[model samples]
Target: MNLNQLKISVRLVGAFIVVAMVGAALGLFAIFNMRTLNDADTDLYERETVGLALVKEANVQRYAAVVGLRDAVLATSAESRAAAIKRIEAGRAKSLELMAQARQKADDAESQAAYAKVDEAWKADQNALDEVLKLLAASEPMQDSPVLQHLRDVVAPPSIKVGMMMTELTQSQERRAQQVSDANTALYENSRNVMLALIVVGVVVGVGLGVVISRSVTRPLAVAVDSAERISKGDLMQPLQAQGKDETAVLLRALESMRGQLVEVVGRIRQGSQSVSLASAEIAQGNQ
Candidate 1:
């Protein structure tokens, strides 16, 4: 159906509804993307950032354990050796706890595999440390003893392997964190572009609807005004076309009816004047 056939109020309301729908779409799109970005940020913090911190802390503790073990082997007095052993035990315990926590955060298969390798290397290193501790407890060897050579050959290599593995694990966590950060950056860019496009589309649609509604009302009113002007100047022969069911069409119909009534009244007045003139002429002739 033609939009002009609708009431002026209905036409205006329809235009508003169209614009409102576009606005609603933009709002919903923004909400959904914002929710997505929030989720990404939470995951980055919880998984990537926290996990990397855990891995780094574990590596530090592992290094401390290796250092304490070396100090125990090189200690000159019993009390110093005991103190070094205490440090070794404390560092091992803390490192194990942190490694467990880091392992729990490994979500992907590759990360889990890397943690597994680190765990295996750490176990080997712990076993080697325990062997050296046992030797030291039994003999309390001197600094240049065969036990020192044994420590260098057996215990130190395993500790070095563990450090290397820890380094690898730390690198893995850093890479994963970087990947997550990059993905978030890309998602933000994509969301920004999409929102801008939606805004542009909404503006265009709103403007187009406003123009259409305005013209539909204004064009019909212009025609009505012209018809009224002609009627005021006593030029009533021109007919008005009242083609729609709107208020403008009703006004035009009313004006056409008034014009028809005026034409009928004028015709009656002209015939009456002609009849009076004829009667006056006949009376004069008779009198002559």
Candidate 2:
């Protein structure tokens, strides 16, 4: 290609690079955004799992307290009402705390369900505690079969149900957390693969363009060298029809025209020298 054409090709290459840079930049931004979203999902899953675990722990403690209270009521010793009350209040506080935390999460479906169940369980516990405390405050028979039966009907059943609910919530939380981890891993892998592919493509395209440009630069120089070699072999009888309107083309044309003119001038000078020698010989013959 000529210089102007090569310059145009270079400009086109520059534009291609610019477009590639933009695309790469946009891809990079998308990767960053995906990572950000993945982090958010992961953080939310952790908090939710922690909240469910908290609720499960609180439920177990409360269930244990219920069993202990049942045993206490079955005894003839003084009622441990203060300790029972403390346990119930602590359980309530823990449930509320965990539920609140779970609700405060940004966008987790499973966590919200777990929190709902915990809230219902809290309400049930509150109602059950109220009834149990009232029954005990009336000094119901400590060892009576009827009172033990009544405790069986209310506190025991609710505790068992709440504990089961917490167990289910915990399992659900575990599954959801695992899913989030898997999704994040997949996203990271996909991003890495995509970026690697783009880089490979970029390198291949860049090398190909480099070869084309190098050829463009070298082709004219090669033609000029060949022209010089031909001139050195005394083969400039015909003018060179140079391809491009460049300095090299002008130089070769000038040298080729000079060769033709020099050949004509030498012919003229030889004819004049022969004419002079003939004139001198005629003069000498006339003198003789």
Candidate 3:
């Protein structure tokens, strides 16, 4: 169950695998965040930026139509009036097309409602314009005519209301864009913090694994070296505490066996010397 019981090669490979796993985890986390950020950027560009551009262009066309109507009303010549009427028709058509495109791009209920209000105001304005055109075709005098009064009171108000509604829609898009930008910023900060934390954790885990594996190999080797040195110096009294099924344990067992053999040989040599000394003393006493 001890780490040191495993082969040195296995322990080293296990440590490397652990470090690689940590690195892989960090890599996957980074990839996920990058994908999220890319999605956010795509949404901002496609929905917010493109939609805002469409709405602004539609508003410009609406203003052009209003200007053309004014010019038609104030024209002093028949040619100028016809040209003004042509401009009015072209502007109206273009504005309608642009607004339809903008409406198609409206994804949320609030934006759809705003577009509905704009359409209603545009319809009212168009009706008032039609009435004024009819009065002009009738060759009515504009000095104190009911047509001019109606144009001022009815046509102008709805056109202005349309402009106001468009302005509100534009503001809403701007606010939504700002919200998306702020969300992206917050997301980036959160991702940055999380990545840093992951990096720190990975580093700590790798270092810890390296230290543990290194000690498991080297600590036992140090013990083996010290035991060998003591045996070389004829200090055989100390016991080598070898525990495991590893090569180090085998080496320690061999050393312990060699030490026991050396102790037995030295004891036999001492006994033989004592026996020879006693024999020499007995011979000298017999000769005296």
Q: Give one digit per residue, the lDDT tens place, for model 3 in 1-288.
A: 899798664677577667767786866778677768867786766676867777786777778777778867766567767887887898889888977877777799999999889889989999999998887767733354577667656786787677667767776777787677767767777777677677777767776776677666667777778878998898878877778888777877788788888888878998999999999999999999
Q: How many residue pairs clash in each candidate?
A: 0, 0, 0
Model 2, CA-based lDDT? 0.66
- Candidate 3, after superposition: displacement of residue 74 in Å? 6.8
Rank list by lDDT: 1, 3, 2
Candidate whose lDDT is highest: 1
Candidate 1 — what's its lDDT?
A: 0.78
All candidates: TM-score: 0.55, 0.49, 0.54
Which digits, one per residue and each the tens of the lDDT, describe model 2 over residues 236-287?
A: 5645565667665676667667667766876788899999999999999999
Worst 10 residues of 2 by lDDT: 75-84
Pitting candidate 1 against candidate 3, the one with the higher lDDT is: 1
Candidate 1, TM-score vs. the true structure? Answer: 0.55
lDDT tens string, model 1, 1-52?
A: 9987986646775677677677868667886777687677867766768787
Q: Which stretches of candidate 1 lie over 4 Å from their true place?
A: 1-5, 141-288
Among these predictions, the greatest TM-score belongs to 1
TM-score of 3: 0.54
In model 3, which regions exceed 4 Å deviation?
A: 1-58, 61-141, 241-288
